[model samples]
Target: MNQELISHDGPGHRWLAERQVAGVKLGLERVKNLLKRMGDPQDTPAVAIVAGTNGKGSTSAMLAALCDEAGLQVGHFTSPHLVETRERYRVNGRCISAEQLDAALVHVRDCAGSDLAVTPFEVMAAAAYWLFRDLDLAVMEVGLGGRLDATNVTDPIVAVITQIARDHTRVLGDTLAAIAQEKVAVARQGRPVVMAHPTVTLAALRRIGLTCPVRKVGKDVQVQDVRIGGAGLGTQAVLRGRALSEPLQIELSLPGRHQLNNAAAAVLAYQEICAAWPKAWPDAVEVVWRLAEVPWPARLEVIETSPMMIVDGAHNTAGMRALAETMAERGKRWQVVLSVRDNRDPEPLIRELSAVSEGFWLPRMQADRMWDPHKLAEVIDLCAPHADVAVGSAQGCFEEARRQAHRSCGVVVTGSLYGIGEWLGRGEIVSPRLRRWLDGQAPQDQ
Candidate 1:
């Protein structure tokens, strides 16, 4: 079949899209059940499982990059591609080859025949496991809450939790502590855990410390030296006693200081992994280059020249805070293509964003779950008062913002990753991985 014929209309997309996954399977029984039927490929993989409220993609990207640099034939699994489904699965710093994906899916379908009436993620997890088992590495990002997430089926050498914050209240829980517990439960016994400054659940933190032998990022793996120039940036991780620093002065093409922190976390993860497997770890310079080379979209990504249009997936409070901080640091003013979750508290976020960006046209986001563009506008008015709030879908608001937005000023499409993908997809200028993933093309031998 021509590549053009494969689409949302095709059997492939429909099969996964139509069937929903259980957000909380509660146990690995179903995954184990599926694997037992297929052949347990994930039981003892050299894995780096990263769980967090924000920066999971960035952290995963960096982890995979560093691991690959360390001379490992890496396999990575992420979620909700900005462009294509294939972006969700990667091996050796590239999207999984079409041949690889096809073989894995064929086997998974055969074993899952009728018994694995599980969610789409469960099916993908199975497929990823099959593909990863053939590779030298297995770095997986948890799809949602950690405890019952499909990726949890893998036993990791390094279990990493990026940071803690609440986004999905309905499925996870109401309180921060409850949500943290759900995520921390993903940490298995004996693996060395690493994470950024966590402020969610003290109980969860204590539990992880006792049960999983954890390491707080800055405490265990700190950044000793950082140089941020243009085109690339590099930092040194104080790995145990050894100073793992690669001094490279450059700015990341991905944009934003938040990425720097994400980079820092990845460095820690890389250091920990290197210490765990010295024979596999490469030199520090190569790892730094690979980290800079990673492709993470919708984080202050500039796509236009005239009125530089940027998009980000700042969907939660922590994400919003990072976005605000990045904007403040840039000092380059911008108008926003804004939409926020209906469930999220708008006042605090509005107050933070007010210091940097403004809404372009509408009052808020669409009438989707936890989305209220109108409510967002009202909050902007009440909290920031000065920042203008946009009130339309990605396309509508973007067009309006383009017309009114000054050439000197820039456009930022943010507040939700959904909105970012929507606008960027429509515009056809999102990051290459997302675009290729959506298109389902195999990245040529690279």
Candidate 2:
């Protein structure tokens, strides 16, 4: 857990904060046991587990929205929240109140007595499941790789893998195939696993020992005539898939051509769900058109217009590549304010980013394992010798970058979602819960 995340003043918050000492234990035993004690709320609702390196969050959000449009009360769980911890749990696109989260945490703590050891993420997952016990369906974005991920305890009706790439190398191995193996394990024998990335083929999945049916993007679901929208707009495409009755015209509110793959995966996953429940199916055209209304934050999220300021959660190489590709298509160079987690290999991210960047501003982030600004600057110099670089506090770097971009190109804050959260907290785009946290107050204390 990050230092800032643990600083909240509340009983439930304190309980979760103390579990940070146990750190990230990536196994399912403790979580499964903890949820069992809570009466296994995870088993009550229909589940769709989304696993991938880059686009899982967007894919999960899109799947939830599609389900919502079909008249299902949907619960969504995502990790490493951008602004508020409560953002991790949502029902029908609305975040649960702090009281709801805290009450659930209290129940989780009582269920997880002294004997049952659990990590922070496990506790959160348990709470989300318990809170969502009555919901019609739930969409969970895997916090890490899927096989042993805590979220894998549920038997998903459908599994979604979107754009697997080299990430978490220290834990998931150093190759894309090795990473895909871990992600694909979320699938079961009878269910369908939607594979959206071009690199992860049915052959690769077969080699990795997959028994479940694989529905690939280009084959099972096709996205054609992809038009990357201009500045301040999103991509539009025609979705054609075996799961759909006919080809549907789709417009994504989230920018970047990369999202087309994610959208396809969501559609396939929803179709798989409908196959099982039959009654869950809605008017295909009406619900498919709702893709344009999905509200996922921080992926090319624009915070301002004049001298446009955008914040993206492009921390890894694949994510940075997508961001770069989007910028290249728009033919716009940006002044970037960036910081990444220390565990990542920053060279590839810098190389991809520098290609579409005018300059770089390395900001200090108030989270654990964030890269040192000076160290990041050294890599930036090696990666793009022509681009100017600055290193300082978050406020200093953001102000300087804003000023420089105002004179020339637009400004982008990216490289880490935590860094974007800090920037969002300081700017006008803040949730009330996050504003309270930034001000060091409990929600009720304010």
Candidate 3:
């Protein structure tokens, strides 16, 4: 490793940050070249590539937990970190340390050869491969559409797609079928492709002519006895599939009906790879129960009680609608603190929030991609002419929302993960577990 790049606060992070200027090039040549220079670290023995519009991160986390429970060393790579950049890489349920991240980035930077133009995400993907080169299995979440995503360079044993919806339409396409085709492009020939999306997307995949075998959730695997836990608890369901002789009961720490599909998809992917392991692994039931302990942050996560406040990273229209439906199912009115990335179309998200929230608070995130608060307020007013809207810093908006909310009402902080990270960084929300996890410390019991 380069001595200058090893300092956490020094040139290491700056080197990575400077590459942000290239910003989201949807191609594989740069990443492929970087990996080749790094001795093709992604050529691992076992790998699973997960792609979808919404639930891919949760599915990756669930799959990592199941593999860990079965006594396997697991490495997970996901995107858009909540608090720290190291959160994007994890091994055996723990975030990568700053030292480890800096070391890995040094290798990635050196391997890029000083001439190849690489994006920030591609660099991170390369570093993850270098950091976890010796792990037993790797679970990688596609940062964007799957076809040319930086994480797609690896030859995956199984490609999993969870709940395809309308997102990144400019690059992928405007139609659902077009998006589905891009998502399933990660599927390899003669390998199993696991999916948990609707029939429309399934039909779209078929229309695109999928050559690999597909194991669908509702068709190939059965999800029965679905139940949501009470009072902010997670969800429970039964999973039945060809991989198991009998139905497996599952309990998950992640909430929402959508998460059930993610869990089922993870289980199906696990089944596809279980036969390749050398030792006797845990039973399906045991793996399902162990999934309940996976701590995936900022997805309908509750941080406080009394004037209850929850933070979720729901940016797209479909994700916002799902959050609204989940709130409605609880029979509680909520106050919303919203911020969005500059690239997103905010009209639909604002309309969804207006339907579920009694009022809106518009906060400016510290990140460069955040939308302006003044323009966001105008959109909120246009969508919800009768609703009260406030604009300020995230901390000020959160404070005002808490003061205005009734004791029985819930408060939701959402729109972008960057906003949620800002909220957590300000120490306004007291979640020791999340704090510990971000700081590279083991989480304590709640």
What digit string (tens of lDDT, one per residue) describes model 3 on residues 1-446? 01111225745577888787787798999999989999998996489999999999999999988888888888999977865778788888888888779878877888786799999889988988888899989899999999889999977989899888899899999988889888888887778888888575567666666677778888767878878656664688888767576888888788888888888889888877785566677776766777777787888877776677777899998889888877776554578888888889889998887776778888766667778989988998899877788888767888888987764367888898766776676675655446656666532232
State residue 133's C-alpha deviation in candidate 1, in Å.
1.4
Could you tell me how far off, in angstroms, the CA of residue 347 lies in candidate 1 after the best superposition?
4.3
**Model 2 lDDT per residue over 1-446, tens place:** 13444433567777987787889889999998999899999999999999989899999988998888888999999988765577788888777776778788889999999988799899999998998999989899999988888899988999998888888887887888888888888888778988887466455567766678777888887889988755675689998867678888999878878888899888888888888885747856879767786766777876667767777889888899888887776555689888888877789998998878988998776666789989989999999887899988877886788788876658877788777776676562433433443344422244
**lDDT at 1 for candidate 3?**
9
Span of ten consecutive residues with least summed lDDT in model 3? 1-10
Q: Return the TM-score for candidate 1, rounded to 2 decimals.
A: 0.83
Better of 1 and 2 by TM-score: 2
TM-score, each model? 0.83, 0.92, 0.93
In order of TM-score, best first, we have 3, 2, 1
| Cα displacement (Å) at residue 442, model 1 | 10
Model 1 bad stretches (over 4 Å): 1-12, 21-26, 97-103, 198-205, 208-213, 224-251, 278-280, 341-347, 363-375, 390-396, 436-446
lDDT of 3 at 434: 61
Off by over 4 Å in 2: 1-8, 198-201, 207-209, 278-280, 428-446
